[model samples]
Target: FTPLLLENTQAYEAGKTGTEIPNVVHGVGVFSVIGGSGSTLGLIIAVLIFGKVQAERTVIGISIAPGLFEINEPVIFGIPIVMNPVYMLPFIAGPTILAAVSYILMDTGIIERVCLSAPWVTPPILYQFLATGGGIKAAVFTAIEIVGLTILWLPFVMISNKQNVSEE
Candidate 1:
């Protein structure tokens, strides 16, 4: 259902003719991809740097490739983010915050609103570029989103680090 974020991009356009939104609407399709995969990559790096748990490592290994293409099932299901309390907050909050930032950026004209609908399978930075009709600002915004999401994922990752070390 995450791919639905990339669907119906044009619905954001206030004017039907132009590729640009001209004005913000429902923030529909404003984000190129959901933040899950980005957070997953961030989690992977966080685990590698600070986590000692082999279980975390295994899940991270399983998640890396799919996370690249914006697929997050391995991380979501493997980490069991569905019902796990430790991972849930950041998992939900990071994307919500990023979406707000994205909406602000586009609304303020710092980044162009999405003009074209990119396939959900498109990679992160590249997806932003294509979604914005080759705008570098969108790509830059996506890079920033990745970094911020990574930071948001850190405390939770460190929690895992501590939890794992304790159980050992």
Candidate 2:
């Protein structure tokens, strides 16, 4: 997908300069981490502030560091979100909405498109900054996305709290 995205973007006239790379390539890193560490960070904060389930702490503890590095298997498997109805919506919607917003921002030229490639493992704000050739707007936009993703996950985390209480 990364290669295809890069090819597609480069095929376009606007993308030829690398400044106008599309969401597919530019968003690769964003999308990869947004759902993983990004959402996990939100879940951790939400649980700490609002959760009643003491057991969630274990999940948070295990997930926090990896989440920072854009790895979320612990959160996903720990939360058991695979078949959980409560988490499905925000889990999918957060990244989708973010990508859309990113696309819009790039389309309108409000922020520079990703003109550089960085390791997907790079932290979120830093990755955006490098991808945009050190553009501040991209970094700012990534920060906004992190906040927004956190907000998106908050209510769901709270809902899971309820489920946890009920189950215990």
Candidate 3:
């Protein structure tokens, strides 16, 4: 995924340089992680976008948490997050939006205690409900997260459309 993503990155950079590098390349191992880590990332994203949420307190940021253990990229790829339309939107949008909102809320004292630390990997709606002490159901969060991710997916897909394209 990083290579594929870089394919687009290099292309964009080359575009600026007025050179035709024809950057991207594709092959097997495409869907290899789809069933495993991709699903996991999808689940976590589903939870955040549609589920509970995060940010701030430098030592306690939700974004930086999974990253501490080098667990983030798996979710990024395992959820097959890079290209799958179903999992892509929330993977990008949910985190971007949540990071901003959480930062503002914490900085403004709107919500405190800094989220502490919740499990990094849980199904979308279930994680949300659990994160909130099981105070809610999955249906509502799932619907909203789907919309959020979809909105995110639109622009992302449009921009990086052919970068990592795999017909497999």
C-alpha TM-scores of all predictions: 0.80, 0.80, 0.34
| Model 3 lDDT, residue 130, Cα | 41
- Candidate 2: clashing pairs of residues: none
Off by over 4 Å in 3: 1-94, 102-118, 137-142, 162-168
Tell me the deviation in Å of residue 31 in model 3.
27
lDDT winner = 2
The stretch of ten residues in a row with the least summed lDDT in candidate 3 is 26-35
Can you rank all candidates by lDDT, best first? 2, 1, 3
- lDDT of all predictions: 0.67, 0.68, 0.36
Please state the error at residue 10 of candidate 1 in Å. Answer: 8.1
Worst 10 residues of 2 by lDDT: 11-20
For 40-140, candidate 1 gives per-residue lDDT tens digits of 65666566676687787888887777887778888888866778788888876766677777777777778766667677677778887887767798888
On the 0 to 100 scale, the lDDT of residue 86 in model 1 is 87
Scored by TM-score, the top model is 1
TM match of model 3 to true structure = 0.34
Q: List the candidate 2 regions with Cα displacement exceeding 4 Å.
A: 1-25, 28-32, 35-39
| Model 2, C-alpha of 2: deviation from truth (Å) | 5.7
Instruction: Give the Cα error of residue 20 in candidate 1, in Å.
Output: 5.9
